[model samples]
Target: MPTPASPQRRIGVLLVNLGTPDSPQTPDVRRYLNEFLTDGRVIDMPAAVRYPLFQGLVVPLRAPKSAKIYQQLWTERGSPLLYHGLDLQKLVQEKLGKDYVVAFGMRYQNPSIEKALDELRAAAVDRIIVLPLFPQYAAASTGSVQEKVMDIVSKWWVVPSISFISTFTDDPGFIGTFVTLGKAEMAKREYDHVVFSYHGIPERHVLKGSHNNYCKLGTCCNSYNKNNRYCYRAQCYETSRQLAAGLGLAPEQYTTSFQSRLQSRLRDPWLQPYTDEVLKEMPAKGIKNVLTFSPAFVADCLETTIEVGLEFKEMFEEAGGEHWQLVPSLNSHPQWVEGVVNMIHRN
Candidate 1:
């Protein structure tokens, strides 16, 4: 028979997300990018090639340019992703009450996964539930967090029973919350089109991570199949479908696209129509007003704020489109808080 856990055993909840640098300076951005991009799971390159390429080339060339963008997005409260993560930890703690201890960590930067694990260990938690904040599973995002969690726990003398949520891309409550917010925004403005934009990853990286043969990189993701439905691209499209259904949106009025793809060329393709490309074509398509949602990101950050919000808006405007609105992220929405609490309790 399996042994029963001690009645006094405590449970810990660790919420993780891709991190942001502490400041908007070039040095800070360089360090943050170095740590983030250098991870084997993230860049998927050999250390010999990746290390020098990142340290010597990418960081030096990209940091100054990226830092300028971060500076525009930085606020008195610091990186939006980090602060929102902190706020979520506080709110989830309150909602879950004293039964479960909740903590937050960044996969790559400050308040890191190691530090979060230490906090839980110090509290002597008997069980831990790790919830990576990526709605969709990608090796470069959630997989990296899971790898770090295992790395930390493997070193512990008394490792706790662990439960990891790989992804919640189609969680009914999560989808409902997003739909509610998007609908609310649409009600306020008469947008001619609704665009669902999700963060992009290299196509090769995604195909490399898929466990099934279904992700053939083309029309395979248009319809969800039970086998590969859990694929990141499939789930992203499913997220859009559910949200669109909830909002009573017609097929012609809404479209799904990928955004923020890094440099890569592989025979297998990524989920597309790309966001920027779509925006540039909007005016010609007779879609003047647009509403965009970044469902892949639960918290507002550079990807959503600058990439989707400002950059896409500018592109649409430049292309002669009229209103371009971005739906706010699910920062601490009540239903989202409830979802976190439920996930903790259920595990």
Candidate 2:
């Protein structure tokens, strides 16, 4: 145990997300990106290689461009990602009530995990459920959260009983939240094809966790199984499959693609067909109007708002498509709040 305990007991929950910049300014963006990119679970390279490359090259080169995109995503309420997470925390806390205390932290920026954990500890919480707000269990997302929480809590002299909600990508309530949202959006706009766009991770990350080369990154990831249980790509496909099934979409009517890949050669073999590439090709394939879903993210942020919702929309327009609409993310919707409440109760 890392900290001495007074034996006062209570129950608590901590919600975590990928995080956002403290502001849309360049320096703040640099701080957030530097911390995010330097995580081993994210880069998966040795310090000798990762720190210099990230600090010297990646952060300096990308922070300005990223800061600009974040500026576009900023709201009167501040960062959408942070505000959404904060609201979700409040909603869940209210739902849980006197029985459980809830706090939220970001993996990289403000509302740090340490502070959230400290809140739980200060409340004398003896049992905690750590919910990483990612639907899928990618090492870079859920794994990174799990690792950071442990590294922080492991130092306490009286460590609490902690259970991490690694992934809820397949949970009915989770799938249902998106399904409900997706169906509503579809009713508003008709498109030539529906595309499920997930955040792209390097193929090597998936292969590393997949047991014994079980994932070939082909049709093998088309479904979920014990073999590809931790395979992020497979799980993304699974999310798409279940959502499509719920929306009464035929497999042929929709396609799944990866988006927001870092093109630096180090991130080679990112999950593909890339969303932008897919957009460019779809127009030529007798498809024009498009509807897109980004289930990998629960909140609408720079990636979902600008990258897919704006940038890809432009790409489709340039490719001679008439319309390209994005389904808004599951951010603090009544259904999503309910789904999260259910997850806590179940946990």
Candidate 3:
């Protein structure tokens, strides 16, 4: 008699985001900050140094202030980041159909990665595809997600085939979504210049990951290649380049910058042409009307929605700029949902 074949099993898809506090309250925000800042990849400090510093000084000192920001960020739907991730999870699940099992998790706090992986394990998935929702790869975000998943699943008695989608910055759908959003904003107002601001990482992090000390962190990032392919700053520039090209912008028409650095005198230097500094300088440069794009984020989180949209706009106008507008992020836009589905298929 012929040997029996193994039973069919669905492919598991786990989508992860950076995470948010359980609530906008100070205590909840403090707990969230404690978890987020304590990660070695994030602070890039030794346990002896990182834990005490963040848990004792940073978390306690910043919690109330950060809580106020989170409070402003909170909506009737609660955290935009969490809700958007949930919505994307449902959309991707519906599109992928019954052949795949989809789960959503945050790297830290509630709905943890361990919970998501357990759901997949219960489904007896033959293979699991881990997709960290960050379009660009960074040790602090995407890398943390990958590390957490492996640490959780390594103990499984029967491990399934596993893979990760690291970076999709150059994906047509990713670039096109921003292009569409940017174009919509530009059409509404004639701006003198455009700004592309990505979230800033400490300069040392990029230097630490520098392959054979290849990254100069200057014009070197103007071109992306194998040597600097994984460099976060380079990846940001590449995204800006692609978006600029898609929007038919010349070199002088747009500028690339970084934002949201931890404002600490003790901290190491962060990536520059800092977004705030650039925005303030624009008025003196005679660029009055400005349109900004926070391509670093896919959803309108505190960073994009408040930092770039509200805070930055106020800074621009105060510095004598006439108009400043922020392009919205790709939350549940049909095109972005389709793009994400295509990524799932392609990977």
Candidate 4:
């Protein structure tokens, strides 16, 4: 049998998210985008090709408009994504008690990974559990986080034991909390259809994740199997399946789609049907009123609050759809809070 952990072993828990702009201004947004997009996992291009794209094109053109969106998403306390993460950190810390030191940080900008790591190191933690706030595994999200953390910690004078939670695709408590939240929303109104819209990665991201031709971009991903278990696309579909089964949804009652694709030089197709395109055509298929669930994001951020909640609402309204209901993300909800506590304990 394995040796039991020491009684004096102090633990540090770091909760992480994608990130937010330091401020909701053009320059701030530009700076944030410059750092975020330049990550190799995010852009996935060599420095020779990636440098010009963000500096000359992406950041310069998108910053101003993206700033306006952040302005709308900003709260009196600060960005919703940042504040919600703080709340979650506090809640989980309280539940875990005095032995554990819990801190929240963003992959980019303020409360950065460097700051969070420094906090843990100063505390003289015996071991660290780094949990990326994403439910599903994607290299651009979880992989980027793991790589960044290790790179920083490797230089520490005295490195301690480290653990990382890459994904929670099949955790019972994790899936159950979402089902509870979704059912509560569905009871308030009857919807014509429900859509599980996940953030889109470049199609090559999915193909690169597949093992031995596991992902055929066909019905193959519709079911979960060992070959495709690590695949991001497959895990997303599995989340949708579990929630749909819990809610007693019929096979035809819901569908999966992807959102936030970039216009890159490569013609590689992102996942389909695209959420924006699908929303426009949903009304024509006799499904006027709809509800959307963005499971990829735990906290309602730019993509969830503005992109799906507000922007897509406008699109559906313009298309003559009667209703566009967006299920709020699981941001420090009580059940979700407890569930996260359980997840930390599992490690």
Model 2 weakest 10-residue run by lDDT: 260-269
The better-scoring model by lDDT among 1 and 4 is 4
Inter-residue clash pairs, candidate 4: none
TM-scores of all candidate predictions against the true structure: 0.95, 0.95, 0.97, 0.96
For model 3, give the 10-residue run with minimal summed lDDT: 262-271
Deviation of model 2 at 31, angstroms: 0.6
Which clashing pairs does model 3 show?
Answer: none
| Model 4 poorest 10 in a row by lDDT | 263-272
- The count of backbone overlaps in candidate 1 is 0
lDDT of 1 at 87: 93
The Cα error of candidate 3 at residue 78, in Å, is 0.6
lDDT for residue 61 in candidate 1, whole number 0-100: 93
lDDT of 4 by residue, 205-270 (tens): 889888997788778887887888878888989999998898889879998889998864258678
Give candidates' CA RMSD values in order.
2.9, 3.8, 1.5, 3.0
lDDT (0-100) at residue 176 of candidate 1?
83
Cα lDDT for residue 289, candidate 2: 85
Q: List the residue pairs that clash in candidate 1.
A: none
Q: Which pairs clash (backbone N, Cα, C closer than 3 Å) in model 2?
A: 1-157, 2-155, 2-156, 2-157, 3-156, 3-157, 3-158
Q: What local lDDT does model 1 show for residue 129? A: 95
